[model samples]
Target: MTWHVFIKELKDSIRDRKTIFLSVLLPILFNVGLLFFLENVMMNEKVEQVTVAVDSNTDPVVISWLQELKELEVELVEDPVKVVKDGDALVAFIADADFITKLEKNEIPSISVFADPTSTKGGTTQDLISNVLTIKKQEYIAQRLADNNIDPLTIEPFQINIESISEGDDMSLYMISIFAQLIIVLAVLMGGLPAANDLFAGEKERKTMEALLMTPVNRFHIIVGKWMTISALSMLSGIFSCITFIIGVNLFTERLADALQLDKNIGFFTVSLLVGIIFFALLISSIQMIISLLANNLKEAQNYISPITTLAMVPYFVLIGVSVTELNSTHFMIPFLNIYALIKQLIYGIYDVTSILLVVGSSVVFIIITFVIAYAMFMKSKWVLGKS
Candidate 1:
């Protein structure tokens, strides 16, 4: 391909407002906007007040336990059951007057926690009460163990230490995976349309494609030049998107680190992230070019390429559905699936060279197929000349 022709195409692309918007401005705005909204949501705790009704016979220990959580507003009242049933309280605790007597007799005292599970605050209040009750029960167990001259640790016999084997095991990585998936979907949706429109229908509409085909340059060279330009533009958008995302992540680093339960060095994932972005961009761009080349007009091209964009997004939902599923070579060879899986692994700091190789290999193969098809379309007299 002539450098002059490539430069001309690049300049033309730079002048296209739609190209600039898709390739740079839109990705940046989307990343920043999404992060800002999520940060605000994460920082704000929505709990207003928790109302808990207590029966007349409720134990002092239970009442005190409920009252101790200053963040929660607990109200003690007669007829706790009635209050809960009437929707006057978010939760109700009913303790029998004989609870202490039953405990002394070594009988499990049954206490019913009543709450409307469907109510807004009911679930939260119920969970809070359950946690408090569990602690009280554990305390009672420890006391019982002490009374019997037994150590609680000996009775438990074994201590289990749960350790996460995944690298970057934090909330940030999880959130990043979600953001990455969204970026892929957005890149395809926004970039696919214009790339298809410009290469296929736009050329037809402009009537310049016919004259260009009359030149002595080989069809393969012409297609390669155009493909490189479109791919570069798409890749530019993808890179910008990743940069914006990293910036947003850095902005909320303190809060996100806490929320994600991450160490200070989560930013190290940036390298692998950019690698994934470039790979994904190339794959989607090639697919868009092929789809666009198949269309007869802008409207027809959009109709054809729209489904491809949706197809590109299918793996995102599929990956979410099967996130816990084991990874294998079969899974690694699939196009979008490999990217999503590798991204998850990358975020978690699990680097499997074999999987990466497979993904890269599959991508290269697909890229080759796309170029071959694109060249065939470029060589077709009617299609290249816009006579059909």
Candidate 2:
């Protein structure tokens, strides 16, 4: 009898094009569009090239040095500082009049680099010019030593090396963590909403509720079957969301794929992730279904669910700026945030048995609680009979 109700509900949902679109096509389009926009933003944020203006009377070494640096354009100007001030150049170098003579005479000569410190582009260009000046100074010192019949290598200096003891240098986990919360939340809301509306308000509006109630099957079976159907449909959306993310990360962004640190044979891990998604979907669907059951009609349910959808995303946005190390066991008790933390841990390759057990145990407890609440709403005789 339960299977019959479940099959009937599943068939009805399949016939509804809105359910299919929300569960499948919507996630694909949204994920692709967001990734494309982000890729463009990352690409466009780069400093393409810097233009450095030098005074015509500047030493030849500095001019040659600036020209040799990659992605730099060197221009000889009558007044380098004026060129920079007039916005014709990012930065300008004004050399001392005694430039080469001072170097040859072993005297420290000062040159002025003109730039606006407040501007990002100007500041970046100035830094590049400053590095070039440092390198040129080192070259001048070497040349002076060679001219005096001394080995330039005799100047002693200690070498420093940097080696990281942690995992590889992929930082896209931060982006993936935020995106996981967003897509999973959206999948639950969008996928379950249509079905939730139909389960109560649609039946009430279409005048089909009395016939279903007249059937000999127990109310518990009817409610349980419908709840399973709603959870299944929501899980479909989660599947679509996961597919979209995997494809986008692996194909569109190598950095993100590396950050995820996935195993080549990810079958077991994938199954576990899908299981987590399904349980989360079950909880969200029950709440939405309960809300829909209380509303008088589909329009009322829509009005109610809109605010809930926004409320659902609040935790994700709050945690978007937060780091992994900052999160602790307390975060595991929050609704949406718990799932976020779980998925983040999975992505970063942290799979403590106790952690998974805690998340699954908490989820099962919430699922049972929500199911009881939704069933109570479903069994309301007055609401079911249109008396209220």
Candidate 3:
């Protein structure tokens, strides 16, 4: 019976230590342990003070004010522009001789902030210096007004209040997007590989293929049963990885919940997510099985599958290279890349029917092609009996 074959294959796969570790343990290690370690290190480390380069023409009082601020460190350099250009300083201040006198005169003076536009460090340093200068100017105005026997509030006629309408941090979508991609690649590949090799090459190598061929059951039933078994394992691996990521986020990143939108959405995955995940898992499993069936032995199968396994991670690289907004119709045709884009958009709470239909339809077409190819290869007596 097809059910019996499915059950037998599933049990055999479940008993393998390699399947257990690859499907379950490795995903946890990849998603939870690795992400936590990297993020924690970045978040907890002490930030170094911003080093600002300034020339002698800069006002001593302004320099003193900068040095007194805990966020900054003032470094005097002969040529501040050259220092900034050399990357020794994040920002450089070029001022004329009468910098303080101009401020006292309540006259605005030109002071250049030299920074590398391409560098985040340079931009951050420039912003901090600008903020400090702005506050200091306001203080100077207040003092001048008091000395002139006028009210400081005269200049500040009205105040504007800012109201924000958007919800939790945007990085939430980016984070969850990355997590889903890893789950698909790691889980589907890891869980399906051993089953694929063992079911095909291992059975052939052990001389069991001949006996299975003599059975009354149709070959279609056998292949379907085996495919189902492999697909089940693949689905489980992806689910386990997803669950591990969720738990890890809760335990390790509770502080980031507000910013990650976890506090609002709380439950990230829905029914559609599971359906999409399972659909991709089945697709990936079939590809693995096809590769496994091509080789004469387990070792050969592994050698062939290794490169594909590496290539299966193309989605992650694709995500890094392209922004979600830039993705178009053709991009949805790339095997794992489409799934990656879909999963990311799904996490961001996007549910456009066109994207869903594109991936689903493409998957159906590819699966049919691979299945027909695999079935044809499998039906050959020499190939099935390991004579080829």
Candidate 4:
């Protein structure tokens, strides 16, 4: 409440190496490490090469179709079964020599694909073969329709284009949701324990808390001052980490643009992201402050905060496991859930005013509750004077 105390606390925080490290250095390291690791794992990994063996008596059409998948190496072998058994090929295709003749005569032709199901390449090879076979089957069906003087497209009456119409028209909304959720979790993890430590155990250990209580300052002012100090540090860490993430996203966006289906041209997304960051910072800071007030010492505070941080992360993981459209009002009211939902909406360019209001309102409510609890804790003689 007092500018002097606030300024003094800020100076102390800046001078505290532990606080500075947690608030700044740690977040930078975490963001860089995470981005580098993900980039290496996702972008640098080589595409697996598959080998397919076709029987000598296989139909020319099928053989040609196999060849079309040039990315996959195809070889003609005298015995398809032997090729598969000898491990010389990952997959073998055996087709009836008269398969094309039968198809021409309006008869169905069958082909057998063989591989060791337990083999390392089995799943990959099977998927490749299935994709090729599916295309061939579609082609055969289309040809049959054409032969009967019918249009295959007409038979499949309507084609539905499921376009996601978020406000910003960016498909990266889903990925942005995930990143937002992670940011919240990271904020809690980095700040929660240290904030708790400073407010409870640090005060107790310093022996300065009791002397402050004897001063003319209200217990509420003391609590608010301490709370503000820890929350400021926590918010600083959150903001730094978020800024790092945004920068990393911009740098990584080009590479992941196709995979994430992002519309990189949408600049308005930055505005929404900034708004979300403000709300998220306030929300987590308030929550951590309340948790810190509840603990009698640093160790106890950590024990209390750890589970809450984990609980906050649960909704994010749950959302990840489900579809975006499945998000509803219940999720909007949930703490971390609401943050992620709003972020997803923003990323997709769907900035719903009502959703933003709900998130802001909920955060305010939590902040009020946190302050109320902290006020009550501060009023206690033992907590204020640090006697017990």
Best candidate, TM-score: 1
Q: Which stretches of candidate 4 lie over 4 Å from their true place?
A: 32-47, 50-67, 70-128, 141-173, 205-208, 251-275, 321-332, 381-387
TM-score for each predicted model, relative to the true structure: 0.74, 0.71, 0.71, 0.72
lDDT of 4 by residue, 225-298 (tens): 66666666766777787667667766755543443343553455555555665666666766676666566667
Alpha-carbon runs more than 4 Å astray in model 2: 35-166, 385-388
**Top lDDT model:** 2
Alpha-carbon lDDT, every model: 0.71, 0.78, 0.76, 0.69
Candidate 1, run of 10 with poorest lDDT: 257-266
lDDT tens string, model 3, 263-336? 45544454455666677887887887788787888898899998997887876776765666677877677677
The clash count for each model shown is 1, 0, 0, 3
Q: What is the Cα-based lDDT of residue 88 in candidate 1?
A: 80
**Cα distance off (Å), candidate 1, residue 355:** 4.7
> What is the C-alpha lDDT profile of model 2 across 1-388, one tens digit per residue?
8889989998999799988899889988888776665555542346477788889988886577778877688889898888888988888888876777888889999888888888888888778778878978888888888889988768846667897544764345666666766776687668878988888888887778889999999999998888888888888898888878778877786666676766563564576667678878988988887787878788988999888888877877777776666677767666666777777666666665565666677888888888888787778876664544
The better candidate by lDDT, 3 or 4, is 3
- Ten residues in sequence with the least summed lDDT for candidate 2: 38-47
Candidate 4: TM-score?
0.72
TM-score of 3: 0.71
User: What are the C-alpha RMSDs, in order, of all predicted structures?
Assistant: 4.8, 5.6, 5.7, 5.2
